[model samples]
Target: MSDLLANLPGRHLEAWHYTDLKALKSFAFAAPAPAAIDSALLPDLAMNRIVFVNGFLDEALSVLPAWARLSSHEATKSDLPLAILNAQHRQAGIAIDIPDDVDAGAILLISISQAGAPIALFPRHRISLGRNAKLTLIDIAQGEGVYWHNPVSEISLADAAQLSHYRLQDEAEAAFHTATIFADIAASAAYESFSLVLGGQLSRAEFHARLGGAGADIHLNAAQLLAGTQHADFTSVVSHDAPHCASRQTVKSVLAGHSRGVFQGRIEVARAAQKTDGYQMNQALLLSPHAEIDSKPELEIFADDVKCSHGATIGALDPEQIFYLRSRGIPEPEARAMLIRAFIDEALAPVTHDQARALLERAIEGAWSKLVS
Candidate 1:
């Protein structure tokens, strides 16, 4: 795997890069295995499952479903330090292929049982949805001790195909995680992503999406809850390369204690992307005097005939909304929670699956309860 370290960009720790190389130089590659597996909490999932315990792939706990194809190799293909993580550490990973016109579901569960000082783990994944195929993916990342998880995932959508991605990161208090994801949407294709980040000392998720064909549509929504000194960043760049494409993005963050959150979104409509429509917004709620949030929403349009707009709001909870709920015999804490939940309801409301939506709603409420209680 030393070939992966060939002539490439220098590793730099920037706000945009999200990983510190000095902190990732410790762990020596060992075979992957989970210390324990919680069978009850995990249900039977349709998509292939890849489990990584202690920064290595755990073959025993992973299942490659019949409808998918898997392969593993040590090579650098992406353009960032974090994107080609498995190549750098000689760690094992899986590549998934969904056959044409096939409909299925899969989940990848990655956990770190013991992360020692200066240890970093990278989990690399690739997914391809064939023409008219559909798929749903769930990703969960957890780490123990003071560690770093630099993960990268790429997805390509064929004509009329649809992909839905759901990700949850609940690492240990001392762990730091950064993820980069790229999606290419084809004609009449659709892509949707929903993310929840509740646990991490510092976490960042970056997304790059392109509408490569006409009639493409993409929807991106994320909710982040940070407490204490934790920090979370969500950044996305969406480009419309074809005419008649549409995209929408909305992000909501709740910060308490001394935690900080950042949201950056950019939407571009190219000269060829006439008749394109895109919208983006970022909103935050500060639960403590020390909490802080930074939001940047922007739009660049080269097409003379297009509609695009962006909005951002960073403030505390509404007094009137809290009072209205409190006047209805609700307790002060409960009223505040209710108002905060309402602020996030717009993103959760569009989710069609009851179970998935319920899970996210519960996680959001749990974070609020922890902050207020």
Candidate 2:
């Protein structure tokens, strides 16, 4: 533990280039203590809920969905630094399995960290779907005090299965969060996910998706809203190892104050993955002069018949658009906000889940209000 703490990931590594971990070295992290949370803080979703307080399951507050069965925390085969660290102090985790051909409607998994001091919490979760099965997972993370919330999730979809995973990260203003997700999709399977980041002093959300069988598809999309001195990074890598697979990514960032945002997206197509179609695009809107954005879009293809492309754009709000809105009797503040909302709408368009969409909109509204004020 001491060695890992002393040698935390830094900017020297290409993966951590945009986000540094120097500040994390300042805190003396201890094991998280048992904490309680207000029920009102939970989202208003009409589904079974699994709540984790300080990285430990709160069985009293959690009701495992009827279509899902909970199991023990299984071993992880990850080489990433954060995942290794999570395995070190790994506590109880939520493991769920859905059988073949069953359509599991939806479930909510919420993690809340309410600590009084600087502590560290690690939560590992796994979800697997059988052949032709379908499921929707709404994962939300929010917290109260100074702490580190490092979570790792492993997801697998069998042939002909479909999984819709949505995430909302609205942690405390002083919290540090780093999440890693791994998804494996088989033939004719689809893994669609969208993550909205609105909190954490310094946070990074990384995803790795692999097309292990033919006819697989993946959609990895995300949006980040940052204010004050907050820093947020969204990085993803999609691998197409089979023929006729498709992947798409669209990321947006709204920066305010002195906040900084980063997006690094890479698409890899193997030699045998012929007829692969992959596309990635990242756009950022800087709301303040001091705000910063770093965009890196990459494509590495080894297939001759694959269509892969990547693009990135970074700019401020167009003055002409704001002026046009103001001329229509709209205030300057409202005008600017209208444009920002329009920019984010494209990324949020893919989310069709009613409750999940509402949760994201509410959080985005609150973050914009706080950012401007």
Candidate 3:
């Protein structure tokens, strides 16, 4: 009943400057309908899992853990344009609530979108951690055909809670995907997150994390590997409204063909957050002359005693290094891949979950196999 384009963000806005939505206006997206996919296509990760197909829950394929449940969507309080769009068509999402002092091992949230007429899907998911609770969440997005997958996740961490969040975005070559995450962390809570962007025609992932209590902290790290004409964007805004809080971000992008990558990160420290420690870095490696990358890192501080910094770098692979590897009898394609793996090693360090780490690394390997040689 509502007009979807009424509030769609475009290049005119600074947030969407590098990424545009004008192409979306051309499609008449029908509501998401049921679609089937082969189980073989799913990743071989070992974890309690839930599956969503075309925005609808596939109960038959889901294996929920004790800490997760099928529940009504939690209304989001986000005013971001992407969140607002997701809220409009949100159907169902799983809610994971870990009580105090519990360690819920690992949970996998898999989204599979099959090919069909142009459609749009919005899935709203929630995660909550009680005092001192711990959890590892692996979120994988993979799909086929032309469509838009817009999802929103709301996270809450009580005092002293620790959460390791790993996300992999591997949408279809013709699909458009946008994911918005809102995290509220309490005193002494830590949210460690890493996202790997490998697919999607035009995609963007945005994070809004707020340190609401003293001593809270966050680590946001991501890597984007793209080829062809693909476009991907990683945007994050971290706010420190409480004292003694800290935030760190390191994002890397590897571009080939004419693909483009964008990273926008901002850390805001309030006057009362005197002990805040914030740092951000964005780096990119260009494999083609036509490839492009945009990096924007910012720090806004009102606290006189806070330590905050931000920086960015964009460059191509070192020709001398490639020549040296060749002199050592290494092939060009393999050498390039080796350097890329080394470039992203720091970004992957925060991924402590062995299985999830392997899965993400494998995906990158697969991408490069097709891209190089």
Residue clash pairs of candidate 3: none
Task: Give the alpha-carbon lDDT of every model.
Answer: 0.74, 0.88, 0.89
Q: Which stretches of candidate 2 lie over 4 Å from their true place?
A: 1-4, 66-72
Write the residue-wise lDDT of candidate 1 on 1-373 in tens digits. Answer: 2333242224354435432233333434233344555554443454467766765566677786765434455454766555655456544455767788988754555455465544556666678889998877777776567766667777889999988787777778877777788898999999988888888887888898999999999988888888898889898989999999999888989888998888889898999999998988889989989998888777889998888888888889888988888889999898887777787777654365555565566667667766766
Clashing pairs counted in every model: 2, 0, 0
**TM-score (C-alpha) between model 1 and the true structure:** 0.86
Cα lDDT of model 3 by residue, 1-373, tens digit: 2387677997888999999887788787778888777788777777788888887777788788888887767576667888987787677888999999999988889999986787788888899999999999999998888888888899999999999999999999989999999999999999999999998999999999999999999999999999999999999999999999989999999998999999999899899999899989999998889999988888888889988888889888898999999899999999988898898888987899999989998888888875565
Rank all candidate structures by their lDDT, best first, as comma-separated numbers.
3, 2, 1
Q: What is candidate 3's local distance difference test score?
A: 0.89
Clashes of 2: 0
The runs of at least 3 residues in candidate 1 whose Cα sits more than 4 Å from the true structure, single-residue gaps closed, are 1-48, 73-76, 84-87, 106-113, 116-118
- Per-residue lDDT, model 2, residue 175, is 93
Give the better candidate number (1 or 2) by TM-score: 2
In angstroms, give how far residue 256 of model 3 lies from its true place: 0.8
